[model samples]
Target chain A: MKRPFILIVAALTLLATAVPALAQDATPTPVPPICLNYVGQPDDIRTSYYMGEGLGYYASGEFSRAINSFTCVIFEIDANYAPAYMARALVLTQRSDYERALEDYTRAIQLNGTDLSGYNNRGIVYTLQREYDEALADFNQALELDSRSVVARNNRAVVYALQGEYELAIADLQQAIETTGIDAVLADLLDPEREEGTPPIRDYDLIEAQPYALLGIIYSAFALDNYQAYLRLTGSNGDFRIQSAAGALESRFTFDLRLDDGTWLLVADFAPEG
Target chain B: MRRTGLIGTRFASSLPLIILIFLIGVFTAAAQESPEPVATPDPSGVTVESCRELTERTAGALSIRTDAVAPFFIGLGDAAFADEDYTPAIEAYSCAILADPTYAPAFMNRGYAFFAQRADPLALADFNRAVELDPALALAYNYRGMLYTVQGNFGLALGDFTVALTLNPDDASAYNNRAVVHAAEGNYDLAMFDIDSALLIDPEYPAVYATRSAIYTALALIDAEAYRSRAGEAARYPNGSPIEVMGGLESAAETGSFATWLAFLTRR
Candidate 1:
């Protein structure tokens, strides 16, 4: 028994010594290399790093810094990068530098033909410049690309309004509102990955200005006079405020009148307390 | 045999330590195989020039010119206002003004932010500065008129509204506002005419209908049965108009500022 036990102890010691040696000799599994379309293409790390830096700066409201990072990728890393151009163009739009913004947008479009945002954003610049026909054409092209594009459709509505085609404008707004819901286009302007700290203001898209303006125009044109007609058309008493010229009594009342258009006009009176 | 037993006991004592060493080797190898965690960029005090430096340090960095740093902050303010974060919006607009003192929109928007925060004195100062900087800004006149109206200075309110109208006749909301002033002065006929004009401009205006109803109600109180009958007759569109419009008037306090007015005027 004693001899066998001695043999077992010797075996245990040998096994313990060999286990570590075996681990040392074992070859590690090789990591696969990141795939690239072509062998001579720029290394993915530098390109991705700058792109990430650009986006990070943008989120921090350092637009000029963001532009610099994007510029580095375009000039140094890859001249053909469409996203760099597009991002730069968006920042330029906020600056109201329409001409250069248009140029950058055009370049981005040239780089990537299928992207709808390039056309849509360029059309917004056109709208801001009051280049209505050009704006319409771009909007139409974007629509053809994707009929359900809320951004393009809302933009088209603004164009119609600018042209003084109220009916068509209202129709477009109704459709856009129904399909995408109110303030849906506002979503595109927001960055989802933005941190929860104080965020910077984005430029107002004129598309957001259409519906209310149209509503005001519509109510103005109808001129509903009868209280019932006013309620039938707009289901609320139009109460307006007025401070009494005689006493400190402020009163709220609905103002209505009969018009030649065979419509009843209703307005709210808001009277302030003295 | 005694020596053999001693060796066995020593081997058993060292077993746990040997196993611990083997586990440590496996863990170290795994740690080596994993990629390093990326460091997040420091966002503190990040500015336009700092960004330029980041690119300049890199190989092949181009010298690019950027413009309208002021407007960028104004946009930031506008965005904060949209999110209903009035404090940050005020700060952003202030930053915009600092970047470009001539930027009238910054003053105008800052005025709006002040109004939203109930800082009336500050709002008045900014609005005044906005009009001084750009007299052609119709929105400044519009909001200033609203402030005058709230303060019971109807004369000033009327003057400001008239100026806003003179600047932009297409402002349907201004027409609606002027009609309110007319009604307040007990000039019902003039009020009726202004309301008609507002309706002519924007038939879809939800508040005008309510304003129109108030006019008739006030008219009825004056002549009682006669105006009431007229109001009732107007309500009858032969067999009665189809469809009911439902909503409320946008408070002047809410739509008083140009920036807030634009937001409210465009709300669906």
Candidate 2:
């Protein structure tokens, strides 16, 4: 009976101590999920290991090794894995085996209609081979299924630009910028990185890209203000535009200064890269 | 011994009431906690400008707490107008007025740009509607008076200029414009008085000097010396000024430059 009384007293004291804190934390918090970038673990470990090794090789600039690893995963480890086949085909594309890459991409798309990566990869291949109309149609459908789809938007813009529809390309990019707030969509893809299994394209980060957009916009706006000031004095539209445009990560730079009496003068020399 | 033990048991039994009180306090505390703050959407919806954006119209986009999306369009239009790109500016301003039944500034701006573009009829229509929306719009009355004078409607011009003058006593443009109408009707005294009022507000204006010069020139033509030379020259100055010395009609009918010029000016 005494033990029952002591237990009752202790329970009452604990409840009194905890009630106010629980009451203070009554509002529910909104937790957004972390978006994943790479493929996750498959049911089979050998195929997963092969896929992981391939990705690691690709990330480390060993395109040949990545291609070899992915092909082994596709042929020997798991014949039914769509991603394994897709990864091998990407290696073929890096090696400029476009015909074989197109076949694998088509097969992947046949198996899964929702995998935007397959469509985007094929569309890029179509763009490189100059099958513009087909590429545009595929990009348009990709955008329709996923309006937040920046890859489809950017690829379509590239096709439009190659077709001499500069304004249309700019318009599409503008919409993509507004939709996803990704400034890299507007960045020029000057260099095509190639290796055994790596795609001959920059691995532009397409994750929640608000920071990239904000930084790009701020940089461009600053350049605009500076270029406009220069234009006020020089009145050369082409020169001002060239000075303000974003260059490749690696590019040579030259500066030519002309004197009042038509003499070539050198004022400054600097490279154009960030 | 039994009585004291019964009393202690009664005290122990009151513990249920204390536990009930504690739970009620916890429940009350939970009830007193404030709800989480929600993220409210912007009341002014996203305004899609002409360049570097999506669609032109904000039709499907809802601006919270407003049925009039016209103001946002009008704001976009105003920014374009400041850039002096009048074509897109006019399109935006027109859409703004179409969205709102009572946007007077848009009417004023659209009228001004149309006038600059030499679309005079449209300018007149907008100015008229702006004044109708608010009769006390002094700038509208002044512009309407100028348009009427350009079309040779002197009586209407005078009335509008008078109304503008009544609203803004310091409006020198109204006085100058009214003086033009007076000079047309040959009321030189009233015309000179209006010119004087305009000059008081804006001295050293070259156009005012030009107007006064024209009036003096007309007055000097009736002097005795001018009458003799003009009549001797044998040309009948229209408005019934008679010329006594001229060649026969057949002799003077070679090119007919003077008569043609006179006829065109008369039509105007």
Candidate 3:
């Protein structure tokens, strides 16, 4: 199963129309990939709500409903809206409809290739089909486009390790940890290169700020190697914590961890305790 | 306001649905300690009031500082899974569930978190609630089916797999997962047939090949009477587990990541 991450760029595309900016580069390129919110007056703003509703549905784990909602937005407003297709494609992927997911990813790319998510996401589908060569190609392009993208680097490292290229995998992991020390997996990945004076990776941040540590510590306690703590904390003690981003500027996550016999148990009922 | 489960039997049940909570019976007398006020949205819930009340107070007890508890727990769960911190993520999700019994997504999400953590029982409970809260949710059934198959519960596995399949015919996971149960039951023909079915829907799926390889093994192992060594060899080594030679399935499955999450649901 593909591990789900905090979907930012893709969420933006799905939530907002995400049109490209109309600025010209000194080198005579037409327009950059950076776009503004939906335009053309008050009527278009409704599209944004439809998109947000779709994202919320997605967040709530209702993929099919989210697809329908997004499809409705597409049909009701701009049929060419890429987010609608992208959102639907995500549902298709959950359904294991790779060809269709790939098709949508392709269209998403064609609609806006500069945003590295399209290539990176398509690459994931290719990897699922064991199309490593193709998966590698996509990861390569993704890394090329955004060299700082820790997710792409970490994923590429996984591909490398599966191919038995331990060294390459280690290098990629090293770089990923260096670039984003806040990555849970990177921290979980015990590397030999840490002794080589590697710089500590940066923390995960929100768009509003440089990055608030990504609160990644809540995620990396698995390999900590304890069993009793895991079993002790595995179940809900007849209660849960409820929380949200609430559009807050700070980055804090409600987190608890336990180690249960070769298993890492974590509980995160989001609330802004802090 | 209402316990999501049965309202009659539970002493300390904390569900958004009242009926299911009280059905558990033994936890009923201790309802007063549950932390939330139990509202008898329906007339039959007198016993659940004290129990549900305790659950509610505890559920809403997150301090302002603890306000990030649920989402933090959920994010931590996913992140922990990504980092292979399965144990910690499991704890995180469980806490999230406790914090809000009404949080259906927490149960579903935590169920997946537990699966990755290899904690089958916990995962089963989460998937159970996820499906219970949303009957048309195909992902929950598909997951529960896989868990059942792993335990060799073919009857249960088949039921869930069938339910999932009915929900989404094109879902390769539902097909591949059911195929394993078939293979385990010595029905190589039916098992291999499912693999073919999955591939038909998803030509590029590498997991199907891994699954098919297992079917090849089952065929070669059990169909010894029908095929001589040569025939057995043909059936089993039809390119030797396909993807192992191609070096694709594991890596491909890995790439799915968050990029490929689809849930099959009815129009509702």
lDDT, model 2, position B44: 20
Worst 10 residues of 2 chain A by lDDT: A265-274
Judge candidate 3 at residue B201 and give its lDDT.
Answer: 97
True interface contacts reproduced, per candidate:
0.00, 0.00, 0.07
- DockQ of all candidate complexes: 0.01, 0.00, 0.03
Residue B66, model 1: Cα distance from true site in angstroms = 6.7
Write down the worst ten-residue block by lDDT for model 1 chain B: B239-248
Model 3, runs deviating above 4 Å? A1-274, B1-73, B222-268
Cα lDDT tens digits for candidate 2, B128-240: 66675666677777787778888888766777777778778787778888778777877555566667788998887777778876765555454434755866766555433
lDDT of 1 by residue, A199-239 (tens): 34444445444455545544443332233344455444433
Q: lDDT per residue, candidate 1, B8-80, as tens digits?
A: 5654664574345435433432343232222212112334464344323321121122222444455445545
TM-score of each: 0.34, 0.33, 0.34
- How much lDDT does each candidate structure score? 0.58, 0.55, 0.53
lDDT for each residue of candidate 3 in A1-274, tens digit (9 for 90 to 100): 2334446656777656534433422222212222122233243443543454344345446565556555655666666666556656666666677787788778866776676666777777776776777877888888888898766665665566446455676676667656765445355335665665555454444321212222222122211212224434654341222111211111221223211110111111112110
Q: Quick one: ranking by DockQ, best first?
A: 3, 1, 2
- For candidate 3, report its TM-score: 0.34
**Chain B alone, TM-score of each model?**
0.56, 0.52, 0.55
TM-score of 2: 0.33
